[model samples]
Target chain A: MTSRSALLVLADGRFPAGGHAHSGGAEAAVRAGRVKDAAGLESFCRGRLHTTGLTSAALAAAAAYGLDPAALDAAADARTPSPALRAVARRLGRQLMRAARATWPSPRLDALAAMYPRGAHQPVVLGTTALAAGLDAEDAAYCVAYETVGGPATAVVRLLGLDPYQATAVLARLVPEMDQVAERAAAAARQGIDALPAASAPLLDLTAEQHAAWPVRLFAS
Target chain B: MDRVSLRATARIVADADGGLPLLVSDGPLALRRTRAAGPYTRVTVVGAMSAPLGGDRLAVETEVRDGARLLVDSAAATLALPGRSAEPAAYDVRITVGEEGVLRWLPEQLVSVQGSDLRMRTVVELAPTARLVLREEQILGRHGEPPGTLVTRLTVRRAGRPLLDQELAFGPGASGGWDGGAVLGGHRATGQLLVVEPGFAEKPVEPRLLGENGAVSPLAGPAALVSVVAPDALAVRRLLDAALAELAPF
Candidate 1:
């Protein structure tokens, strides 16, 4: 039986997926003075959710809906223009695969891991994990959409030492928008890969590249 | 505004006469073969009249045959103005580079004026040994005015494999938060430089930042992309020019 609680577990911050090391460009944004407080963080997350967040959620939903993983990997690469971001996705994918395999054993995950031993895109692996957990495409999309902002929110707490409750409140306010974005993503996935959203965050792409070159940065990207 | 469907074609092929490139032009896009001091054929795009108004379907196709080296540029910036009909203007550019061919597509900036809407698509296909240096810049609006809606997509394929495919949107009707702190950050001018050299396959480029607003990163293939968001066109050009000099020198 498909359990809805699996979505909660997958979306949880303590999923052991190596996501704690990354800030999804929040580190760069914070250092650049674009994000200095809760309001700034909210604005930044909202921007990311609609652009890269929507694109990623759709990719994950498509993979969960049984689209070809290889093709989706190529599409993800095309959508991600920054080489640094690409490396981060692959690394996070490898880490997520390791954790998901142990949590929910499946031959599909094994096949994907074998096909891309180094790693695939994180969203593709995430969708495969959702499939293994007997979850639907919307579930996968929800997980990605939430994580898209959650990663930054948590990182900003540590980076800026802002109030944790305030950070959580920022995420709480985005809950409705995240649901709308997830629904849009699931619908977009049904339309096929070509119809997927190509929304881009150029500043995120630029800042992520700069973050990767930083030797003293706390986040991986 | 007059709504018209126009298609223009340009072709370049290297001949036995000292490897000089052949040139062709058609319709509103007048192609003039100009003399250059370097070992390359230079073609200038002189606009026959104001074009790319809304509700217009326009296309410019250019091909570089094997063993040819071509450089293409425009005389002035292309302005997208509003049309009477609500239909958005479409501008399509198709470029092909054959084996051992080199193409430098350095057109002037494209400015989206107030109340105009445009959708532009640029597709490039390159052989395995071909080299390309392409630059694209977009100005959101005229001075002190908010921009109209504009969307652009660039797709490049090398040797039957996808190298890069990206789409950017701005102004009204685009997805929300495009001008927010995480996307354009209210920057009016944005541009990128793409350099595809087969030699990079052996020694890939190292990712780095260009000043405060630009970044250069290597693609999955033998190419490098430099993206910048700045306050104006001149600032955008400065970073792109620096990146071009570092990535692809004459």
Candidate 2:
């Protein structure tokens, strides 16, 4: 049996990955006045958790299920509409690959790094890393689903100066939905890549594109 | 379960004297060539029934052979009406372009009336040297009526490799709504234009936010995908045309 701690190690906020630079669209949302305080942050996170968050969880789960890495990468590229978001995904993937290789020391991980020297998509790398760590698809899904909201919650605390306690409470309230999303994602991963969810948030896509053009910004994307 | 299946192919055949290109098509879908002042052949949708009702299935398949240049246009906008059966309406479009082939498809807007449920899928396969310029616009509902449900999926591939894949769902509450959480963000009309070709370059274009909201971004294959959202169809069209002008010669 795979130790559950493996998931903790991968999902840790300070996993030495490049996630800190990204606000997960929180920067954009904050600039547009969509996320002013803790309540608005919850609404934003909920919208994201159901849409892009669910999509990422399913992709990670499928990767952990041992699907073809190249195909999953292509699907990831297809599902993401914004070029700016894609660039961030690849950059983070490259960073995660470096950390995963040192921590897990798996041949598959090495091969994937060599295949995509520039970088693979982040969720693809995360899922494969979970596989390398001997975790199941649901574990991988939970890790990504949590990070999807966690990263943004931390960013909101910095961007809006919201109370850290309030932000933590927001995440606490979302735990049940996050678990449901992860469960559905793992279930879909078993079916096939075609069955994966294509839920998209157009406002996020548009705002991300707009954010990329900004001259100065706190977060990368 | 009856469907209005339509299939058509456009190929350039060498003339007896090998001088001018001849365009030929065979299917229920009509093809009327226009004397447009351009290097490409302009074909208008003349005879085919364009509107689709609930539970109605419609398909249009087109192929452009090597060295052929075809431009397709619709005479009027397509209105998706409420289904007669329990299931929603469905439309599928498949297009293929051969080597050195160029295709430009500019169809009119698709309006989804209230209580209507429509699913539309479009797939485009292109050869290595082929180029495609496609445009699609959708309106939520008629004047002063709540919008219906619309699910659209578009996939583009070159040489068996995926270039662009996008799926959008719009309408009531969770899938979409006028609230800030909705995909449309309270916009009633939305449009997208895709330009794909070899050695495509990204150009700098100013954002169009005066009358409508829009953005243009480069895709993985060096192509460009432009999206525009407006309060009405006219605004969306104006914004789309402005964006397309910046990335023209597709």
The lDDT per prediction is 0.88, 0.78
Which segments of model 2 are wrong by more than 4 Å?
A: A37-39, A163-180, A194-197, B1-37, B46-50, B173-182, B201-212
Q: Please give the C-alpha DockQ score of model 2.
A: 0.38
lDDT of 2 by residue, B1-250 (tens): 2544333443333222222355454443455666653767676765444446677666766777777777778777778777556677777878888888888888888898888888988889989888888999989899878878888888888888777777777776342122343255567888889887676734433332323277776676757788776788998788778767767665
Q: What is the per-residue lDDT of model 2 for residues A163-214, given as tens digits with 9 covering 90 to 100?
A: 9999999999989989998999999999998777766666777888778888
Superposed Cα deviation of residue B141, candidate 2 (Å): 2.3
Error of 2 at A156 (Å): 2.4
- Worst lDDT run of 10 residues, candidate 1 chain B, spans B11-20
Model 2, first chain, TM-score of 0.98
> How far off is residue A72 in model 1, in Å?
2.2
